[model samples]
Each structure stands twice: as structure tokens, then as C-alpha cells.
Target: MSQAITFKNRVWENAGLLLFPDNFDEKKTYPAIISIHPIGSCKEQTSSNVYGKALAAAGFVVLAIDAAFQGESGGEPRFIEDPYERVEDIRCAVDYLVTLPYVEENRIGILGICGGGAYALNAAMTERRLKAVVSITGVNFGRLLRDGFAGGTPVESLEAVAKQRTAEARGAALFVNNMLPASVEDGKKAGIEDIDVLEATDYYKTPRGRQPNGATSVLFSRLSTGLGWDAFHLAEVLLTQPILVVVGDKPGGFGAYRDGFEIVRRAKSEKKELLAVKGQSHYDLYDKPEAVSQALEKAIPFFREHL
Candidate 1:
């Protein structure tokens, strides 16, 4: 049975929900999985809840959270994205999970969707308690903010973005924009190139993935904080634990996942695996049965084996 629970993130003083398994036995310690949602999306918006339910049904206790400043979590100046605080939120979730009588502290694992995926990787690096990690359609926020997609712009451009944001902050405008831009027109139009699939637009704009709280952006003042978000840079060095990276074979997100998989593989860590789902697009994996089931089929076993 799932009951609403809250835990605080020391960095932001925010409390988010902890979704547990239905048949959770207080006397028995069970394996736990921390599932993080994508950017601009809350725990309930994306497939995190679905995954949580599925994993819980498979005999695991899952915690699906709303990141700090988003969803039901507590925070001021809503929608602000603090790269460091977000990572710390994951640690806080882990802290809360381990304290539960039904949770297996040493066998905890993490799963992140979209931007949350990147944070999951970052958490694995520092949080020794995370025995395994899985990233699905994850975006490297730092690389995207600094270099844009496909490395289209120089890192110097971020400073200009930051400067503009600083000016906006001084004016106290709050700079509201939808979480993920609705269209390329909403973003830096000149830098981004068009792709065939509606991966970005479909997920952020349509009801399929969009939520009332989704697509909101913090003021430009938050740019500096987000620019420093390099979640995967140290994957090669700190990822000694087991990892499983999943990607869709369809256009738009496939290449990035491939690149991420390669980066993790080169880490020379004995415990790593990569799976590319055939005929699936980035958004397809979010709630689509075929893709989600395939992913869980491969993932649950991996965690069971490793964690």
C-alpha cells in the first residue's frame, strides 16, 4: 500500500513524497529504488510513478520524488533550478530511504529520467550507498547549457547567458518561461538544429508528458547555478559501482545515449551494461508499454544481480 510521506533536503529545506510498495512489510527489509523525474516534470508527470509501481510490484520499495523547488516539494521562488541542490536532494532521499525499517540500506539503487538521469549518475559518484544506477533518456545538463546540443556553440556563450540572467535578477523580474521550451522558437533559435522526431516538443508541450507545473523556468539569475551542473564529467573516475544505461534507438536521443554508454564503458568498471531499445523514441520510453516493460525487464534483473 502506498502512503504519502515527506523527507527534507537540508540544502533547500524541502520535503517530497516517498512512494512505497503496497505490501510493504514493516518487519522485513526490502530493496529500494530511488526514481527521479525529468526536468520541468514532476514525479507524477513522467513515468516515474509507473516505474515505481512496477518495481514495487516486483518486490522492491520505490521512492519517486519531486525535486526541490518543483512539484509538491518545499522551496521558495518556485521553478528555480539549483544544480548542486538537486544532487543533494537525491542524497537526502537516500538518507530517508535507509532510515525506513522496511528498506535495505546497503542494497539501494537509483533511476533517473531525462535530466534526473544525469543527476543519478552524479549521485552514484559521491553517494557510496547507491549500489547501482540507471539513466533513461538522460540529458547532460552542463554540456547542454554550456555547449548546446551537438556542441554547436563555444563554452564562452554560457557567460553571456549568465550575464543576461544577472541583469534580469537585478531587476527582480522572476523571468518565467515554461520548464522545457515549448518549441525551438522559445529557446536560442539560432543555436539549435531541427530533428525529425518531436521528442522535445511533444514531451514538454503536449498532455502526454506535460503538467501544470511542468515547463516553467527560473529567472536568468539561476543560469549561473545551472551552468555549473556537470553531472557526467566524472563518470570515468568516480563510477566504480555497477551501472545500467538505457536509450531509445529512434532519432534525437539515440546518439546522446550511445555517447553516454561509451563514456561509462571506458570507465573500465567491471560492472556496466548498455541496452538500446529498438524502434523506440526518447518519449516512447516514458510511458509506452513495450518500451517501459522491456526496460524494466532488463533493469530489475540487473539491479537484483548487482545491488
Candidate 2:
């Protein structure tokens, strides 16, 4: 059975879909998984719900959620992305799951897709409640936003963002650009390393993955809260927790997964595993059965072992 649920975390309310196992035994606790969608996406847009359904079929309670400022989650000036608040959202999901009678509080895990993957790792560092973490085609937003593709630093990028922030404070409307173009024909040409972004657009802007709230933009004239997003420095620390990093072998996301794996490995985390699926692109895992199933096959057992 599935139903829409609303829960509070501090002052804000978060909305999510709760899928319970068939023939659910309320008297006994079961492992639960909190599936988080990508940036600019809601639970219904991605395969997070598909995976939630699969996991529920496998007897795990699953909660697929819309992050704050996106979908049905409570936040002002919708579609804005705040990395810090997103991490807190993951923690909030954990808190809500623990209170359910059918959930095993100590066996809860998190699965984050794309940008949500980075947030999952960020939450794992401070929120010990997450027994295991899985990141699928996840980008290190802090690294990407601060340093672009080639090379740069967070401080250098912040200067540009700071100017934009100042202009917005001076009555300029802050623009929100779609990560993927609105139309493929009009989409920006992909650079050598941007095949993933192109593939992402193919899915996000199409009916296959599109939802009413899936693709959206927001204008923020307020500078104070609008332009602030810090990098996730705690990734190195988060490696201490059990984590599984999954990436496609395609050009775009594979490199990021390799780079992230190396960083986590160097951190000397003992329970980390990296899996790369051959011939799969970043978007293929979003709704494609073969790729996603292969990942879940590995992921479900990993979480079962650790959580």
C-alpha cells in the first residue's frame, strides 16, 4: 500500500510517498530505504519510485521523497537548490522513518541518485542513523559548482556568484537555468565530457521521466538566501560510513565516479565499494530496467549486509 504523507522537520513540512510491503506485518519491524531523487527532480520523475517499488516488493519499506524547495516539500521560492538544506532533508527523512512502527530504526539506509547521491554522503557523515549509503551517478556538486569542469577553486567561483548575489540584492532577479535544455533541438551542444548532461536532458524533458513538477525554474530576487551554497567538505569524513558508489561506464559520469572513488579510497574508508556498469550512460540508469536492476541487485545485498 502507498499513500502520500506529510511530516515535520523543525519549521518545515516535507511531503513523500510511503510504500509499505504487501502483507506488511505491523507488529514486526522491517528494514527501510529512503530514496532521494536528483536535483531539479521530484520522487515521481525518476526511477527512485520504481526502485522503491522494487524494494518494497522485496519486503523492504521504502520512502521516496521530494527534497525541500522542490515538488510538494515545503519551502519558499520553489526550485531553488541549497546543498546544505538538502542534506538536512535527508536527515529529516531518517528521523521520520524511525518513528514508524514498521520500520527498524537501526536498519535504515539511503539511496541518492545523481545530485542526491552527494547529499546522501554529506548526511552520512553527521547522521549516524543511516546505516548504509548508495550514490548513483552522483556528482560532487561542491566540486563541480566551485571548480567547473576543467579546473578552478570554490573561492574563485564564489567571487562570480558573489557578484550575482550582490546584483540580486540590488533588485535584480536571480535567474534559474535548467540543467538540461528545454528541447533537444535547441539544447546546448555537448562538450566532450558533457554527454551525460545531454543524456540527462533526453530523459528529463521527455515523457519517460517528465512530471508536472519534474522540470522547473525559479526566480529569486532575494540575495541573502538565494545565492548561498557551500561545497560538501565532509565527503572525506563521510567515507567512514558504509557506502556504495555506482556509475555508468559512459564518458560523463564514469570519470566523476572514478575521481570520487579515489578520493574516498584515499580517505581509507573500509566499507566502500565502487561499481561501474559497462555500456551504460548516466541517464540509462534513471528508468532503464537492466541497468537499474543490476545496481539494485548489488545495492540491496550491500545494505542488507551493513544495515
Candidate 3:
């Protein structure tokens, strides 16, 4: 069973989907998992069809949320994917979960996809309420853009773009080019052979994984805040909670996940482990049945043991 719910994040109201196991008993308290979608993604993309609902079906309560400033959540400067605010939103979801009579407050865990995965780890650093965390095909946005994807970007280019975006951020015409191809022809025109990039464009630009509230473009202002932030900052000492890092082994697109998983491996948790799903790209893990099933197999047991 699933129910629609809303909660407040300071003065702003946040909307979410709360999922319960089949044959759920209101009188029994069950373990809960807070499922966070990718950047520029909403609950409908993750919870409605994938991780959130699957985990709930495996006998846990799951709360899939629309981050503040995106999706159905309430916030100003829409489409701003601020890392700090995203981390707080995870904490806020935990707060809402703890208040429910049927949720096991001390047995709560969190799972984040793509950029959301980075924020989940960031939140677990300070918010000890989450007993375990799972990051799937995670990317540390700060490191990804500032340093460039896979290998590092040229320092001069990075600094130049930051300077330009920082200056334009305060102005009213805060528009930037959409990250994904605007159409299928655009993706084909780019001649990018990488399946991850190609699939992402298809997912967002086409009806395959599109959500009305999701966008491929974000406020240029986000660069000002996101560039300076580090997703794995202080993870070595502060992220003591048990963590499971899952990634795809798609040859060319695997570096981002490997980088994040490596950083998370430095944490102090003795229970931490990394699982690589062979023959899949990052986007494949988002909705592909075999990949999703493989991930849930490891994730469900990890949460059961830790949470």
C-alpha cells in the first residue's frame, strides 16, 4: 500500500510518497527506508516504479521524496539542485518517518540514486538517525563538474566557467543550456557512443522516464553553491554508519561510480561493502528489471542486517 503525504521543511512544505509493505499491519512498527531520487528527478521516477516500491514490497516502509526546489516540494528558485539543501531534505524525511506510529524509528535506512546518493551519504555523516545507507551509481556532483567527469577537467576551463556562472547567477536571466539532449535527434547528432549519456537523454527527453515536474535544466545559481561542496568530505571520520555502495560495470561509464564507491570505502564502517552489477550502465540500474532486481537482492539483505 502507498499513501501521499506532505511535511514541512522549515517554512516550506515538502511532498512525498510513503509506501508500506503488502499485508501491512497498522499496529506493527516496521523498518523504514528513505529513498531519494537522482538530481532533477522526482519521487514518481524512483518510487512509483523502482527502488522505493520494491524495497517496500520486501517488507520495509519506504518514503520517496521530491527534493526541495524540485518536483512537488515547496521551495523558491525552482530547479536549484543545492547539495546542502538536498542533504537536509534527507534529514527532514527521517524526521517525518520517526513520527509515524507504524515506522520503526531506530531502524531507519536511506538509499539515494545518482546525485541523491551523494547527498544521502552526506546526511548520514551528521544525522546518525539513519542506521545504514545505500548509494547506487552515485556521483559526487562537485567533483564531477569541478574536476570534470571520469578524468579531471582542465583547471583553466573549470575556473573560467565558474567565474562566468558566479557572475551571472545574481542577475535575472539565470538560464543555462539543458544538460540532456532536447530530442532524440539531438542525442544522435552529438555522436556520443556512451550508453549512459545516450540513455539519460532518452529517459528525460522522451516518455520513457519523464516526469512533468522534472527538468533537464537547472538554475545557473546552483553552480555557485554546488561547486564548493564536496559529497564525501569528512566521510573518513564522520560517516561511521554501515554503508553499501552499488554500481554498474558498464565499461566506459563505470568510473564515476568507482570514484564515489572508493571514497565511501575510506569510511570507518566495518560493515561497508561494494557491489558491482555486471553488464549494466548507470542508467540501466535506474529502471532495468534484471539490474534493479540484482541491486534489491543485495540492498534488502544489507538493510535487514544493519537497520
Candidate 4:
């Protein structure tokens, strides 16, 4: 079972859903796992809803959290998406988990989905308290934004972001980005036929995966920092914890397939594996039972052995 909770992340409070193992007891210590959601998502969605219970059932105390500045968390300027702040979110989760008497501080691990996965990998690079990490379809947001999903987006495009940020600094209203088409029919009419885009729209905009706070939009001003950030920065040098990256074989539906491979290839972790789910797309792993199960099979054993 899971219950709503909140924890300190600097001065702001991060909202979360904490799940415990079956037959849980406060008397015994248990390994804890911090599960983080994707950009533009909340604890009520993928992090808590999809992977949290499954990981908890495997006997790991799980804390699925909403990134600060979003969801039910307290922060100024709601919907902000800053990569550095996200890394702090993970570290602060560890801070809170360690305070619980029943949590085994040294055995803490982390699970991150979509963009959350990338942030997890980045956080684990320096957050040694995280003994193990499981990144599911982790996308390198900055790289994906700087370079398009299939290829390159001109570096000059950043100029537009700079101007937008300046305008916001000058008291202009915060601009928001609509991450997906309102409907599939609208996308088709606009001649947007990317399967990845379509499937994502279907998932986030439809009942299949929609959450009240998971509209998948972001504030336009704070985006430049994310565009400038690299989720895998210095991963080859400092990432030594055991890591397992699971991605779908179908390359589209976001570049996580490509980024996941890059994570395993670049992470200096002595024990790292990249599992490719055949015939599955990136979004398929979001809530698809079969695909999520395939990832959890590898994640559960991997975390158990490492943490």
C-alpha cells in the first residue's frame, strides 16, 4: 500500500507517495528505492502508478516523488523544468529516506522513468548514497532538445530561448509550451506523422495514461537550462554504481532507445547492462504491463544483487 507524504528538498517540500513491501514492519530495516517521474509528470502518474507498486512488491520500500516546482510540491513558478533542480530532488529523497528508522541508509537505490531516468543516472554519478540505479527508457533531455530526436536541431535555435528568457525577466508573462497535439486527428491534419509523437499524444492526452497534473507541458523560460544541461555529463568519469538501463527496440517514441544505449556505453559502472525490449517503443514501457514487467524483471534482480 502507498500513502501520500512530503519531504524536504531545500526549503521547498516535495510531494510523494511512499509504498512499502507486503507485511511491512517499522521494526525491521528495509532497503529503500526512490522512483522519479518524467518531465511534466507528477507522483500520481508513471513514477508512482506504474513502477512504484511493482518495486514495492519486490520488497523494496519505494518513494515515488513529484519533482519540485510541479505536482503537489511547493515551489515558485509552477511547471518549471530545471535539470539541476531535478538532480537535487533525487538527493533530497535520499536525505528524507535516511531519516526513517526502518530504512537501510547504505542500501538505498533509485529508479527513474523517461526523463527521470536520465536525471537518476546523472544524480547517481555524484550521489554515492544511491547504491544502484534502474533507468527505464531514460532520455537525455538536453541532448534531445539541442539535437532533434532523429538528428540535429540547429544550435542557433537557442537564441530564441535566450530572447524568451530575457522577455520573461523584463516582466513578460511566462510562456508555456504545449508538448503534444490536443488530439490524434489534429496531428494527422497538421501532417505530423511521427509514430513517436502520435503514441505519446495518445498516452498523455487520452485516458490511457492521463493524470490531472501530467499535462506534459513546461514553462518556456526555464527550458533553456534544461537545453543547456547534459544528463550524462562526466558519466564516464564518476558513475561507478551498478546500473541497468532498459529501452525498447523500436527507436521512435522519443530517443530513449538511443539515449539508453548511450547511458550503458558511457557509464563507468562496473556492473551495467542495457536491456532492449524487442518490438517495444519508448512509450510502450510507460504503462504497458508486458513491457514494464519485462523491465522490472531485470530491475528487481539487478537492484537486489547490487543494493
What clash count goes with each model?
Answer: 6, 0, 1, 0
Model 3: per-residue Cα lDDT over 51-136, one tens digit each: 98889889999999999988889997788878899988988898898899999889999999988788888899999999999988
Question: Distance from true position, residue 61, model 4, in Å?
Answer: 0.6
Q: Which model scores highest in lDDT?
A: 4
Report lDDT (CA) for all predictions: 0.72, 0.73, 0.81, 0.88
Model 4 over residues 1-307: C-alpha lDDT tens digits?
A: 8888999988889998899999999999999999999888888888888799898999989999988898898888888889999999998889999999999999999999989999999999999999999999998988878775312353555677678879989999988886788998899999987877888888888998888988787887677687778999999999999999999998874689889888899989899999999888888898998899899999999989988
TM-score of the candidate numbered 4? 0.96
- Give the alpha carbon lDDT tens digit for every residue of 206-243 in model 2: 77777888874433222223234432464555557788
Q: State candidate 1's TM-score.
A: 0.87
User: After superposition on all CA atoms, how large is the RMSD of candidate 3?
Assistant: 2.5
> Which ten residues in a row are the worst by lDDT in model 3?
149-158
Best by TM-score: 4
Which candidate, 2 or 4, has the higher TM-score?
4
lDDT of 2 at 141: 58
